[model samples]
Target: MDLPQLGTNLLNRVPPRLLSAAERYLKSVPLLRNRLEKETDSMLAGLEGDLKPYRGQLPTFATLPTQGLSHEQVLGEMSQMKEKEEHRWKDGLVSGAVYHGDSEHIDFLNRVYALNSQSNPLHADLWPSATKFEAEVVAMTAHMLGATEANAGRPPEQHICGALSSGGTESIMLAMKTYRDWARETKGITRPEMVAPSTAHTAFDKAAHYFGIKMVRVPVGPDYRADVKATRKALNRNTIVIIGSAPSFPHGTIDPIEELSELARKRRIGFHTDACLGGFVLPWARKLGYPVPEFDFRLPGVTSMSADTHKFGYAAKGTSVVLYRGTALRSHQYFTATEWPGGIYFSPTFSGSRPGALIAAAWASLVSTGEEGYLDATRRILETADAIKRGIRAIPGLHVLGEPLFVIAFGSDIVDIYKVMERMSARGWSLNGLHKPAAVHICVTQRHTQPGVAERFLEDLRAAVEHVRANPGEKGTMAPVYGMAGTVPFRGILSDLLKKYMDLLYKV
Candidate 1:
């Protein structure tokens, strides 16, 4: 029989769970395992060549060369790689990686980094400037998120405060760990749980796995916003925190933070507003008269928030801000050790010796792009996003998933959206393919706001949709993988495939 007939026979013969287990066992057999290994090796061999293009051209350094390479040689190699990689992002053919690609800003930040490359925030006395930058970054981010209003009459310890983390994942993990500890100590609850929307970032799940907290995910409503009533039902005495997103990463739909936080507030539990994607944009979007909701400390219920300075803030990578309603709650995130062989030791985030240059870069980005600059940038990004959304809606069989600002997700009723995404990839557009609803999205940034970028994107997208509609039988690359990953009954098999793929990343 053919592939379709076989698939139908398998589905008609047995339940999915048993079939999944049997397939898993069959794949574990020696002959099948060998075939799998051969296929994986062949695939990775192609990826290896692409990842290490200079392997044959450059001198090998399995062990560092007997003598050090000259600075000129190192710079030449790096410059070559940079030249090769910068064109796509610089010319606006990609998605959300490079937020601010202006050469002047990059050069300015590089100068700041060079001046402070030797500094380390772990040694406060050695780098007082780093401490100043860190404190100010936190303060400025807090003030932008309504700290001044939240702490109007509060004491310093009871006022909004936080620390700088490497990125959004670290910030979120830090908050989750803090709540787990706080709940255990203050409420004497051994079992800890946190409620969050289904659209919440995977970092929360990672936090739950790492910190031993139970994560309860409440599904979103028809509009793709969090279901506040469902979230209320998911809470219990053991619920230490509740979470909402200010424009989630997948669909970019802002949750009903006001209601969710109010629910948490009435229960006297922590409420974390994950604004990692929107923290820098929404504040300005609200100022621009966008329909933004209360997802900050201005609400009495919100106790914590995570924002990425790297994304829309136009800061360098390796910097994010996690703010708490009060310093007392943030104190639980601190790590201190008094019994070390050396002197006392303490750290606010995960890393022991953090790079001060990144802190300086973050500070410089914020200072250079003040309120006026951010507002202008947000305006451009939103306008570009609006154009893309409108264009997608106009295309036949395609519909915008939800009301989004900078990140717009679209799906199709008559064609496989993944196939369309594959066609878009072929046309030099790198978009995010989302599952569950099987859609795709492009996160508009400063790069996309450049002249003709939005029009080109829409034109290519329309052509791709028409092509997919004409060639319905053509199974393009990556579409089947996406389809299988999304619809497969054996989730464990997919998880294993991911693990193997990650392992390949480390292979030299």
Candidate 2:
């Protein structure tokens, strides 16, 4: 075996703590550190062209102009960039990024954004309209996700309450931080931990890292759902909350939230349902007769949830709702200072000042789309997803990962799926590449419901698979990177690579 592979095998056998220590020690060696830096620099250099295509073609500004450019000049430059970049997503070749690309909807949201551009939710007195929009957006999302049923017999204090967030990540982090504070103040648990399935969003891990909570990830079952028994075994006295996804990001399979949340409730702990992806779609999917499990406030054990108005809700980007079962729990998510030199201050979410325009757009989306519009959109998306799923299954080597509704993940037994993804990318398809099982997925949106998109996707996918099968010896740029990311045992190396990539993104 090669030396690098042999070293990786040895590193894989080491315990996690020891492996981490080894990673530190190895990085301390100048030769190894230099080698890693060189390799990463070489790898990223090849990607700089694709990442910064506007360089040399457009003005590169490292320093601001002494005087601002004219409005017409600025708009002209932006229009050029927009025209160049909008086609892939506008043509229904991209995934998840653009949920509603209709011209009329875009124009309507743009108008709403322009009208509320100066408003800020932080100054509620000055922008009561922003407050109204934020509150109503949260309420509309809550009601859509069974808040009315959940609050039927409860008092106002115990009714579903929430705050508007920047996006799914912020919403999830707010909920996790709330749980940590609630557990500390109420249950005296300082060293807090959370139990979640492996497939739960990584935002939970980000929360754990930020809030100093211990995240205990349990395994999933053969059907790609959370293993309730394993979750039960992972819990301890320090576990303040348990997490389940309405439908996870990678496999798109809903966890057993019914069982998992009940376990949390029986322990008198918190349960958070991450419905960021499925929250806006599954409600309508259930109404349309899809076999969606109980995963929201309708269940008695669910203490919190996050729903992105930006995703399937067809709202503009940068808006989401985070809901809690009671005002008492949500109070922990709030921040207040009484003795500050400036004055007494408070904020509901993570930010001190948030974009009221996004809130207004979210409110507008929820109100304008209404239930009927969401139902129609969900129907079209699910139908398109079903057709794509069938097409993937009909292909010889590929198999669908699970019974997914909108986000469909598929893998191949006879070929490298990453190569197929690269082929798809070459054909203007922007797909999500998943590791652990080495698969690729397309998050079906309103764009994919456009005429002929589904057929084109299937035809391209078949040809991509055939090409990969015929040319097994061919190497592609991204396939090896993905293959190494999925197979390499040294996670620290991959983490370093990602950090470098993030640094590359900031280069002007």
lDDT of 1 at 470: 94
Q: Which stretches of candidate 2 lie over 4 Å from their true place?
A: 1-11
Clashes of each: 0, 0
User: Which one wins on lDDT?
Assistant: 2
| Model 1 ranges with Cα > 4 A deviation | 1-52, 57-60
Candidates' TM-scores?
Answer: 0.94, 0.98
Candidate 1 lDDT over 299-416, as tens digits, reads: 9999999999999888888799999987778889999999999989999999999999999999999998999999999999999999899899999999999898888999987999
Looking at model 2, report the run of 10 residues with the lowest lDDT sum: 4-13
Measured by TM-score, the strongest candidate is 2
- Candidate 2 lDDT, 1-508, residue by residue in tens: 8998688678778899987887888889999999989988888898989999999888889999999999998999999999999999999999899999999999999999999999998999999999999889988899999999999988999999999999999999999999999999999999999999988999999999999999999999877899999999999999999999989999899999999999999999999999999999999999999999999999999999999999988889999999999999999999999999999999998999999999999999889998899999999999999999999999999999978889899998899999999999999999999987889999999999999999999999999999999999988888988988976766898899999999999999
Error of 2 at 406 (Å): 0.9
- Relative to the true structure, how large is the alpha-carbon lDDT of every model? 0.90, 0.94
